[model samples]
Target: MGSVQHLPYSVSNHCPLLVNKESNRSSLRDQRFYFEAWWTLDDSFEGTLTDIWESSSAPLVEKLKIVQIGLKKWARDLKFNKGDKKRRLTKELEILLMDDMDEETLKIHLNIEIDKDEVYWEQRARTNWL
Candidate 1:
């Protein structure tokens, strides 16, 4: 009888090391890309705000008061957004559990769906450009 070779799944197609290396490189690239894009976008927005403030005829105190009010509103909105997300996740988890799903499975699903929304502000912050 001829002996059969049992090739590993990864080796049968390609090297495992190469696959891991590519994945790591892609992840790093994505991180760097997002960081740079975020920084540039932030700088542009700040510059625009500074220009507007510098050119405004409003008194300094009035401008400051307006900015303070805006900031407070922004902070409140951020808190509300976070709370809403948490509530949604909790509701979904409860439904899943009520359907006899395991805790771990529910957690994984909730985390994946809820985590994507954590960056909502980065996009919403641009609306302040006016």
Candidate 2:
């Protein structure tokens, strides 16, 4: 007999999945800074965050705003230097290709960055990874 294939979205455990959706119906709200998961990857992410939080003598809300400002600047600077490592790897690959040297490591690094970029854009586009 041919093996059974599970259909897409089929659940084997016979349990229905319940998803809770957040509604944005609150028309009146206090302004707040939005933090993103990618911000944690920034250089000095933890240090800057801790420094701003610790040094702030303002109210909690003001401290939050200060931290947000610091993080925004840090993220901006990080953005400018983004892809430096990948660019370096690409340059090395070019040299290797020219000299016909081993490029396995460079190719691996490029592949990893490509994967990261793919995921980054996919999340940005709100596409399902599955």
Candidate 3:
């Protein structure tokens, strides 16, 4: 059983219609891997990379495939909500500034800004590539 609905124009100009079916949705495994810029901000990313590289003794292409699989798992475990984190950090910074300066808040705010820069550059690079 399946259903279809017309999605909002704001959803995407290219994909304004939604096809609802158990099999209509593409499996995540079918998707290509693209390394995200903000992934470097995660503490576990380095460990995941090191583990993947060390554990894989296969040839270059096979090793790359392993890396891709490992990274996808890492991404799943990340559970990062960038938008919510940014909003929370921004609010915390505002509150801290209202009373007195806080070093920790400043540090967190700076880190988020760097993450935003990474995303911006990544998008720009993708657009240029296209």
Candidate 4:
């Protein structure tokens, strides 16, 4: 079953309408392969990529497909939370600065900021190039 609702439109002449479906249809999208910039920062990333490449025994085209599948799996297993870590580190660094600034804490905070920027620039480069 579906229901239609009329929404008041602001700045527009026509009224907005929304249709809500009650069916349990899947809403997931078919995500394409995209490399994460932060993956390069991980110590094991190089070895893992090398292993994936060497383990594949297919032609060039097939090998590319295998690598894509392997990368998707690897990304799923990574479980990295960059945004959460950045926010938490920022808060911790602020507290540390209020008391007594430490070299290690400052370094860790800077590293996180660098990682965030790397991801941003990587995406920006891809957008510009494409």
Clashes of each: 0, 0, 0, 0
Once superposed on the true structure, which residue ranges of model 3 sit more than 4 Å away at CA? 1-30, 41-43, 103-114, 117-125
Candidate 1 residue spans exceeding 4 A from truth: 1-56, 86-130
lDDT tens digits by residue: candidate 1, 15-121: 33322222345556543412212222222346544555665567898876555454444444544665675677788788878998777865864664355454445
lDDT of 3 by residue, 68-120 (tens): 99998887655456566666777777787787876595667668666766775
My TM-score estimates for the predictions, one after another, are 0.26, 0.50, 0.52, 0.48
Worst 10 residues of 3 by lDDT: 21-30
lDDT of 2 by residue, 1-130 (tens): 1233334465475645444354333423324454655655444678878987898799988988888888777766766766896798789999999999989988986776666567567667776755
Looking at candidate 4, the ten consecutive residues that score lowest on lDDT are: 23-32
Q: Which candidate model has the greater TM-score, 2 or 4? A: 2
Q: What's the lDDT for candidate 2?
A: 0.70
Query: Residue 58 in model 1: shift from native, Å?
Result: 1.0
Error of 3 at 100 (Å): 1.2
RMSD of each: 19.6, 15.0, 11.8, 11.4
Off by over 4 Å in 4: 1-29, 80-130
Candidate 1: clashing pairs of residues: none
The C-alpha lDDT values of all candidates are 0.52, 0.70, 0.74, 0.73
The residue-level lDDT of candidate 4 at 114 comes to 69
